[model samples]
Target: MFLVALIFIIISYGMVDSLRADYAEKWQLDFQDPATPVMEGIINLHHDLWFFLILIAVFVLWILLRTLWFFDRSRGTVPSKVVHGTVLEIVWTIAPSFILLAIAIPSFALLYSMEESTDPAITLKAIGHQWYWSYEYSDYTTDSESLAFDSYMLPESELKEGQLRLLEVDNRIFLPTHTHLRVLITSSDVLHSWAVPSLGVKVDACPGRLNQASIFLKREGIFYGQCSEICGVNHGFMPIVIEAVPLKEYVSWVSSQIQI
Candidate 1:
């Protein structure tokens, strides 16, 4: 079993650099490709923590095997002798403390970065209903000039060609790439969560209260997410789609909506 695992690890290590996924797959075990700075940092921190986790697992397994082999009745004719070394105790305690410290530094940094909003170029408000999402642009001075829309999931039979069943929505949120965005989320009736895996955002929308988060998209693409929190019978029907475009295209889209 150990030899088989060792061979598997060796093969996987060689293929690590070549294994890249740009989007989510049907049976994906890894994270969807990150499209924002915060998501990139999340991926990096995940890898860093996994390195320590694997190291600790391997060390613990080796110790278990060694103890079994040496302390077994078949190998030892005499009773086991008690041994306690202060250096070993101290080393174990201090080593774990340093490892936790190393892990904490990056964890705290990512949390702070996720919450940081600096001179937002755009502000988007997402209101969650029992089964749909409504968005509003807060930049417009008047209600008539502002853009607002409700995104409803398309029925499986209504989905067009190439559209993902249960994932397609009539209206997708559009944002400009390489721009700072402040998103405020709130629930109208029940609790809901707005999440996008590629963008690494998941904020709960509680009733009568607003939760804010910041996003800085680094690339242009179509990203999909679902309402993570269960609100009602149609909770699974609410899906979130974000279309990231160039600044010029984004402005053109807003203008067209305003004119309508």
Candidate 2:
């Protein structure tokens, strides 16, 4: 009975978070952008080890119950009078070391991939100000125009239908799909963090310093984020939105904006 209840609790917690996440994905998604394959692999690693952990927990529970039912001192059971043995000692040590190595090897590979920026097709620089985000496309240049804009949060009354309350920005950064774009993040006023969970990109925006990360969007979508640093009262109002589109559409957007 207890085990069943424990399982229910676990299922409830998992389903609750999954449901909320699904709701966010359905209602809040302005576009369809799948998670990167490497991020999916990282999640698989977590699932694999968690399965082992659950197995270990079940095994431990069985051993405790067996001892209580038939081998306890109160049941007049004989204590295992055996002492240390070379084989048993070696088995315990070697088994755990192997498990640790198995988890560590892939973990390192994923970590390295997250920070790797090798000859990216484009680069975008983000600057965190008092409350808004300023973006400049460093990869594009022209004598007649430049792609730089300040993105501010849209007022609730001014927001479009189905737009998120605190997650919509006036000027969303646009990037082409299936392109490796490097982002350099920094702050002009204080500390802030640039994070969009689906893209698995998060880096601190610190003043007098710049941090970089690479993002390769697998599909076109509207990814939302907020100014993760509490700079001031309006901190809650500064939202970040990125509209990833096709290459041709992205170029047309640049041309349309620059002519204005």
Q: What is the C-alpha RMSD of each candidate to the true structure, in Å?
A: 8.6, 9.0
Q: Which stretches in model 1 have alpha-carbon errors above 4 Å?
A: 1-23, 77-79, 141-145
lDDT of each: 0.87, 0.77
Q: Please give, for residues 135-216, the per-residue lDDT of candidate 2 as tens digits.
A: 9986656774457889998888897544567777778888898887889999998898887766767789999998998887
Candidate 2 steric clashes: 0
Prediction 1 TM-score vs. true: 0.88
Error of 2 at 226 (Å): 2.8
Which pairs, if any, clash in model 2? none
Give the TM-score (vs. native) of candidate 2.
0.79
